[model samples]
Target: MSCYDTNIYKVARLKAGKTQEGAAEALGISVESLKAYESYSRLPPAGVVDRMCVIYDALYLAYQHNRIASGDVKVIPEIEVLDLPRASIRLINRVIQFAEKRRDRELLTIAEDGVISPEERPLYEEIVAELDGLIQAAMELKVAEAKEL
Candidate 1:
């Protein structure tokens, strides 16, 4: 019953102007199955999620699904749904802030040699967090663009 599962699946469906029965038919699953997924009682398979992404014209749904399916591994960054203009602005801002902060120089310094020393750990963590922010911003922009298509 994670918020990611309930919120994104149901929200995306509704935002796409799809009723439960219609979305179920479009997804080629029973209404009960869709209900289970929407309620977070069961997670949908990746393949089903992929189809839903396309059918509902909501690509962010795929991103959310991948994030949820990753469990504790958490390779996917969390993202917010934004309008195209805001998404673009946020991504550009992230890139600008990263560059202005000399994150690349710091990261290069940290990675110049084979290993990260204990003293460099904090800086390395900061760089990694900034990179994650960049990734999340880019993903948000991508989702916004996808909605336009």
Candidate 2:
């Protein structure tokens, strides 16, 4: 994504009601450095990112950072700040949906032979996608809880 499209650092700082000078001071970096990070001209180090999460009270920044760093790899799932009750309900619904699909049985069957044949590839991918969804829901709930803290 282009810097214009993904100026999350600036957005998070702004959402936290911080000015550029204040955020820069709190982050222990120069205003230009903070601006670089916000503009995506330079990526902040992991440590700075962590401090930003706390300083800005934006835990989602961690997820955003990982997503940005991983790029197309998508090691991190896209998540949103949800209310506690909504997050809980969403997580429960995902669990129920996964269980209803009975993907566990299919996964066991696929793994029983210790190989994924061409015919099984599509099913395997579907199951993995469902599993990733479950993970994402759980992470969303966790983030919601953390935000409540």
Worst 10 residues of 1 by lDDT: 1-10
lDDT per residue for candidate 1 within 43-89, as digits (tens), equals 99998999999988888788888887788976688888889999999
Cα RMSD to native, each candidate?
Answer: 2.4, 2.4
Q: Which portions of model 1 miss their true places by more than 4 Å?
A: 1-5
Best by TM-score: 2
| Collision count of model 1 | 0
Once superposed on the true structure, which residue ranges of model 2 sit more than 4 Å away at CA?
A: 1-5
Per-model TM-score, in order, reads 0.87, 0.91
Cand. 1 Cα-lDDT: 0.87
In model 1, the clashing pairs are none
Q: TM-score of predicted model 2?
A: 0.91
